[model samples]
Target: MGGPSREMTVMRIPLKKAKHHFGASLSRGTRPYNEDAYQAGTIDIPAFAKRRPISLTRNPKGEIKNEVTPAGSSSGDPQVFYFGVFDGHGGNECSGFLMEELHKYIEDAAKDFELESSLQIKGPVHRYIGWSGSAEVDEQMPASGSAPETTAEESLGAVKTYTPSGTESMKPPKPGSKHDGPTPGAKSRQSPLSSAPPVKQSMSVRKAEDLERELVMDWKELVGGYFRRFKPEWFSMSAGGRGHPAEQDVIAKRHYPNSAVPNEAVEGIGIETVLQYAFLRADYDFVSAQVGKRDEDPVLADRAINDDDILGHPSRGGKSIGGTKRFKGGSTCSMALVSTPTPTPFWHPAAPSTVVTAHVGDTRIILCKTATGLAVPLTSNHHPSLPEEATRLRRYAATFVTDSFGEERVSGLANTRAFGDMQSKRIGVSAEAEIRRIEVTSAEYSFMTLVSDGVSGHLSDQEIVDIIKEAQTPEQAARDVTSFATEVSADADNATTLVVRLGGWERRTEGGLGSLGTKELRDWRKAEAENPRGRM
Candidate 1:
């Protein structure tokens, strides 16, 4: 967490080379105290290639009960992987919330999808399954309300229908008569009287459309559900346990569309959805929690002065933090919800996996192409001044003002979207995700990077990619990136980076200056010229 102290730590983990793939992270440096965090790991989800047994419970007489539980949740996997980076501003509380809760929210969203898929067997729009809460949820309060639900029968009922009698055009001609008999020299007759009925959509297409809309809504519910539930309780304590979260959602990345599109691309929709869900839901919780705060000022003030480190660091003592700030802080989230290639029963199980990414600030995730050693940015910065973004704010009813650098900020926010900045949320500053999906290919993918604005603000993506390409190992690559950024990039705030290598990476063992302390430039260049590309 970044705050007063400028301390940092560094370490490495060695995995068995022959079997397990290697993974590593380096967070050892100070960036305005480093309020950024990263997570790179694997999680298990259900196998959707085959239909799962739905009636999972038994009755008193030992007979199977008719259960309507959703189908999702696989026991085995080549394994699902997750990679994320949270950049915090105003303070770390918001980022901390993301570091701890984002993945759970995504997983829960998956379950909601499975449940909806199962629910389609019964009447569709008539019955809403699971929990229904305060109008605050259904209405989403300051946010947009959900679209109206509809069943297949109801939605398709409007499509035109025709009888098999084929209108007035299908009059059967007498056998071997003028209509059926081809008179050798006779001109074709009476064809102008026959015409086909207007085209109507097939039942298959209508059903698919219904499923598509339902899946979209289910995703909205699952993606942001956890963020909505956890932010308030953790902030105020009284709201500790509100939403019912016993069962979790298991979000499938590219595969498992079930009865949806038969031949879909490997990557899912791009740039914006659930990731926005997280930020908005968090803000709603924070804003909603602010109620009665003024009346409870005495209690908050006493707690703050006595607990100076309240909003920031856990070890330091700036104790009187958010008391003055009123906890009106926020965090920028840039994460890649990755579903890596695994053995699945779903179509194209042999095909590659896809990445669904979302962000609400300057944090970035760039994919480096290994074959050519080039940087492929996964997302553009979400700032109000970025052309379309500027237009978007105006359309969304958000106000923007030019900062000292002439960049646009929604309500003075550096980025267009974020979590928990109650002030920012009121204007056009939205948590709505600009979603995007990128298909992960074989050797074309080198590394997918996640970094806060602190690091990105100074180092260019190409520069970062070059550093990564030249480093000896993952940990070494991260160290080189941040150290170079701080020692040279000139930015002052916290700095952190996470790297995911698509292929194997190895460490370098060579001789040179023990560290990158001051050295004569001419001699250093000579030494650099002498080393191979993989050595430094």
Candidate 2:
């Protein structure tokens, strides 16, 4: 007999270990605090109140991958001092994501030519929806009550097969053995082992088809709901300026819940909303300052007036400095995309060519001016009561005053308008914020600090300004504010701060005091050599 016939079998083996390496560190738990219980806490709230000329930046302890640069001063582009403090609710993920991606999104939006085109597009993009066909009913029917039975041959064919050792190939069966099966047409029939019946294998292809149809239907409903809820508000150039067209006339409106009622008003009301609005306003404000056309002759004339030369100077001959209008209170987000004007081939003193656009968000923005002494603000509160916020809050009959949130008086939340929490809007929360443009003169250099309620909640605006003012740089200012809030706040929530300082101005350097660098380095080397096992 031929040596046991050769055959091959393949087996799959799974690996025992996962192939990914995740790098992460555990953060220490925050110090506990009780809101219902009041304990005295001391912060150096007024240490920096005396005006001082200084520059600083503060970064919280972490690994940051982005470049933090001071806004530059150039003739062509307006330098922007960008800052923000993000207060987190629910979890830290949202706040962290905002810090990492907010600027990128803004920059990307700024560069999109399609955005400009979309603004000019007249009509809405109409979408056509359709449904799929349903399963057809069978035309022919089987007799009364019995289900179909499987044939013997078909049942036998469904039985599983196994190979025996020493038999490389499978054969149908032997003629008379107990384990052997007989051919259907043979003279002597041999039964299968133990006379067991064969099992039937069923393929329910129709059931699978039914499930797929249901899934498709569910998906269609989901898509429809998504579109209905998030209908896009296409861009429009006509919507520029604060209170220009007025808040009531704007097509967009916020619907509130029927149950919400205004009780005791709050102080520093709408602080978060105001800060956010201000930051966006700063962006627009600075952009307008840099690019808005003003006749050079008039600006010179205004500057030329002095105690003795008032009569000799010509009356300011140019039109008033034009800027984008302030927004009404209820508006949440704004965008403007304008084409840069072409420079005149020949210098025309009368024609000033520049393009400026402005946009605003509901929360805060940071602005830093390096040219002037630091002036701390009372608080960067953006509560609804400010004139800029009035129009936005009119629809809801909402007013910013002490006790907005029941009895809590110093609710640091400022802006009446912001993104997220649609439910709040239903309860008379307005999402509108004002946007304005203010010129930055040679005597005035300023940086903006934008933050959400998270940071503002625990610290006053002046306190924040003071902290930033004391720091050596804008980055340090931001980090210090965050750290201080984290150290002091009674609540456990997300907090963030952005500090943008103006650059291109000259200031005295600390290094100018003396040349002790070599001596310090030498001392460090000697100390390290002596210690040998030092950790530094």
lDDT of 2 by residue, 460-499 (tens): 3434544555556555665666666555444423444554
Model 1 scores a C-alpha lDDT of 0.43
Find the candidate with the highest lDDT and give its number: 1
Candidate closest to the true structure, highest TM-score: 1
Model 1, span 1-536: residue lDDT tens: 44332112211222212112323344434544556766655434322111111222322111112212121225433344566777777667667777776776655534432322211223321122212231212321121322232222332232222222321211223545555212110111111111111111011322322333443344234443223222211011122221112111112222456523122211121112223334444445454444314533656556644464544556353422223435667777776655432332111112234566666667777765433344466666766656766766676466777878766566767777676666555454545554555644323354566777666775556556656656655566776666665554323457777766553122111111111211232223334345565143
Error of 1 at 154 (Å): 53
| Candidate 2 segments whose C-alpha is farther than 4 A from its true place | 1-85, 92-391, 397-415, 427-433, 441-443, 452-454, 488-493, 504-536
**Under the 3 Å rule for N, CA and C atoms, how many clashes does model 1 have?**
32
